[model samples]
Target: MALEYDLVIIGATAAARVAAIEAVNLQARVALILPHPANGQVHPQSDFYPYALAQIAKTIQTNRGQIQSPSSYPWKYAYTAIDRLEQESSPALLAAMGVDTIFGTGEFCRRPHLAFNINQRYLRARAYLIATGSVSDYPIIPGIQSAGYLTLDRLPSLVEREIPLRWAIIGAESIGVELAQTLAKLGCQVKLIVETEQILPYEDLDFANLIQAQLEADGVRVYLATIVTKVSQENRSKLVVMGDESIDVDEIFIALPDRPFIEPFNLAGVGIDHTDKGISIDNKLRTSHPQIYACGNVCGNVLGGYHSQSLTQYEAKIVVHNALNWRKIKVDYSSYDRLPWAVYTDPPLARVGMTIGAATNSPRRDLIILQKYLKTCPQAILNNITSGFCQIVVTRTGQILGAEIVGQNAPELIQILALAIQQKLKITDLTTFPCLSPSYTEFIYQAAQEWHTYNRNQKQQRQNGWLNCLCWWK
Candidate 1:
């Protein structure tokens, strides 16, 4: 039988799943095509799965003198979540929502026809959403290929074996930081290398300083402004040579950046525009070909930033609405700027809108900047974690530009700033809003007061200069 769907979504990541659900809700027949073996944290080649399994095995072994088999862990967790959901809701919930799941790789057979190799059978679909996410990308470093290092997708499994006591991680992005911390917690001597002058270069300098301090205190050796020239194996240990420096480690885990996994599917034939970054898409999430849409890692919108799964789902919602209701509505992503995000390291750093540097360098150079120290906040004193502060940027007319927090629960605290920015709320609006006493959020009120005071001083200075000019003219 020829299978046809009003909307077809490729990949099963957060964005793809949300697109499928939203399309179905719009009364469109939806077909979701996933990889033969899902490749993500939730399913197949995820690095975190093995660590989670090992934790479960340890728990079971402690309770019952025998350890649970490692291979059964993924299935065990999958069934547990599915069973719990089914028991709490209806078994046919997914199907009833009009989303049909097809397990296979989806490739373009024609302009509007998508061929899916599902369990060794062929299937086709209509409109398609390319949300294939991404895979780890390895750069062409000298001798590194022959050294056999593991990508972020494969590192979790290697960590589960727990064989490598001495480990070297190349790259200090979010994944590198997480792996370095996780392996250190599991008793591995971790050494992290980054080509940049500082770790988390995309983040604010203050946040990076806090994270670097924490990692060093944890006994993790971080080499910054260094590049890995080559990697080779010697005596069953990985020898990584960075410039003139050589380090021997049991395993070399590459937390290096990833590019979109688009080559295998041969997307060029389908007329999709792509670069080293990934597929190109406009604000509306529409690719060069109007009928085809892209989201998530496959698109370069968020790049290396920690875009929450929730935000990707939101982007997918925009894609679905554009695909289904193109006549009645047009998707706009300008308002999507300044989304809040964070690094999950201890003493987490969260930011929204623009940074002081970003604002100064931006075309909006007329912005007013105000910062309040965490030491001034009551909660920071009580918690003994006065390492960071709250910074807010506003315009002369009191319009909020951006906010950043770099202390405990900074991610949670940044939520209010995100909401304020989204609503285009003025700084004055926050002064009257009731806030809890003795909390980190009180810093917002303090920062607002500082901004007002600075604004008044600037106005008085301007008035005095004008009066002096009038006296000279008289």
Candidate 2:
């Protein structure tokens, strides 16, 4: 029997949760499908674990520096907290909302009418949203299949049960660097293995190098510009190889974002467009098929080109509105640049909007770049926490395009930048805005004020060059 509903949201990601809740609010019957029995969002293995590990590392660093504890790593307490976070969602909550939560794989059917086959039951909805999120991507290293390794999603389970010791993370992207630094700070010997010369490659080149240096300073050995060709187990230890050189470790961690989880739907049979990257979506998040929509990291419209829970939550709202309402309101993702993202390191890395790469390809040709290092800031010196800088990109007209920070309270500072960019606030406005003296925020004001000095310097340099060229010609 085919159960009818107003909406059917595939997967149990945060995006799906939002659509389910909104459908319940509209008094529409909604079916929410899960890949497994466990809610992926609350699972101990997902995004929650790396975050838990980072906080534990911070606590360890704080206590050791303060002389409160001699041991730098403590997994016992952190695991306890992680276990608490894994508590499954109450069934009563879903029941109260009237959401039919089915734990099974769903395949869309093309025969007769548009419907999904979940287990043996058929569900036909007025509209469908594909919010299945992403699946993990591992490197193409030989002997990796037989050699057991841990992905970020499965990392919490490893930490919860095993003793903290030797760990070699195979990828220094956001998650890799974050977990590598975390494990190192928590008394584990960590080697961050990446093929790129710099960590956080998506960030500004300078910012990426700065964070890589910070990782090294925190006792993480970063092996850059070389891929792990092979991984094998030797004498109870995992050996990772890069050409002639090799290192042995207890575990290998995959700390990269996931590929879009859309292949199972067999979208091509129904004429929905997608590639290995993800499903293609317009500015309004509509799929090629008029009846289907895709959201979250499963779509090309992902603002940062990374998997983001906050982004999933935001896009979920837009998806639900357009899916159910008679008058489909176009999605306005203009403030997508304002979405603040932070990597949880000792001195965190956070950024928003265009990177140096983005500005180069942008329509705004006359761009101004302003940067200020925290080492020169009074607050950083007083606090003895000065491993950071603030960089901002803007147009000639002073419209803030992007900002990046690497420093204490960087995650918080980026928020101000996010709000400023969202409101289209100008550099002069930030510089004139009164802020507490001897604060990290002064970095923003200082960076903004540097633009005026940069203009004067540029003019002087041009004049001096012109004079020198005239002399040479004579």
Candidate 3:
């Protein structure tokens, strides 16, 4: 006999599991399919490896004057941590949570009413969700595949062997940037090549430059606005060619854009609109077939930002509600303004909402830019770690439009701003918000304070001192 479910999630990713749990909590029968063993089923917390490695690298960097050699602590501990985390989300645990877990590759069948056929079992559901994640999209450079290279997923293999002495990373996405700095800090020679003019093309130019300078200071050779024409094996080393110039390195790492893993599901059988990017969906996270939906990396450009686990979790909630309930709830990433993202570099770079460049190019001309440097913060001075700044964009009337933070605890700091943006809070709210003395959060308060001065100046410029006093008194 075949099984039936209210929701059939067609992937084993973290987002799939999240939706399954939510569906079960909402009193719906849920089944989660573990697609092909090799599909990109990454644990949501896999990002912990890079973040932990960055911390180890920072410690080594701080004591470089006395330390003769950095230890292998990062590799030794980071991989083990990820292994332990993966066990917690194993299929068995998911099954225990009332998610009828099925392990096998599957495809949609239109016959005898819509169902997913897996190992001769017909799993029928009222609605289906495609949460299959994405895999690294290697560029089509000549001879590169033959020469061989590593992607972000393959970096864990480095633990089994020695770190490459010389490395050429072919992209400047967040992973590439984070690893370049971590590797250089560990005493490896790294060359980062970016086809775009800036390291992080989507971020503000000045913020990108700040991270670039930090990478260079850490001994990374940065190549901007350059394209790799070819890659070839030269004796024991690999040569990456860019027009007339070439770089010789012991290994190459490709960090290009990701291609969604949507092939196996046979999306066409059910008429789900999709492209090379991923499945297309309405704001409510519904596919062309009202009975089906898509979320996470599988949604591709339909969503913004890198593959953020937080954003994926948010999408999962909306998917569960819309799939199980008739009263549909639409997803609004708030134009990606309410969703915060971060790159875990040494000091870290975090942003939410519009950047300075984005705001300037936007049609809104009433926006004001305010900046506060870390050097001026007493906490930063006390900790002897002053290296970055916080910049905020707001309206002339003090409403916060967005924020860019590059400094200690940036990821944690951005969340506060993200919440503020989500609530439509003004700069005055942030400035007046109580904060601990001598803390990194003071950076936000200081930046928000500039709005007060700017407002005062505007008021004075419009009228005499006596008029300004009268206005204030009223």
Best by lDDT: 3
Candidate number with the higher TM-score (2 or 3): 3
Candidate 3 lDDT tens digits, 252-361: 98888888888887789989999998899999999999899999998884223477887888999999999988999888766567888888887789988888787788
Per-residue CA lDDT of model 1 for 1-474, tens digit only, reads: 457667778774656776777887788898777764244332322433433433343333221223222243433553454445434323145566767877656566553454544455445544578887777776678887787777656644543453566788888667687567545544457799998888888877766877888877665789999998888879778899998999998888877766776665557767879987889987777788767788877775562365355567777888888777645244455555557877666666777777766876778657887887777787878888667777888888888878878777788888888888989999888876687878877867776778668978988999999999999999
Judge candidate 2 at residue 185 and give its lDDT: 76
Among all candidates shown, the one with the greatest TM-score: 3
TM-score of each: 0.81, 0.85, 0.92
* Cand. 1 TM to true fold: 0.81
Sorting all predicted structures by lDDT, with the top scorer first, yields 3, 2, 1
Indicate whether candidate 2 or candidate 3 has the larger lDDT: 3
**lDDT against true structure, model 1:** 0.70
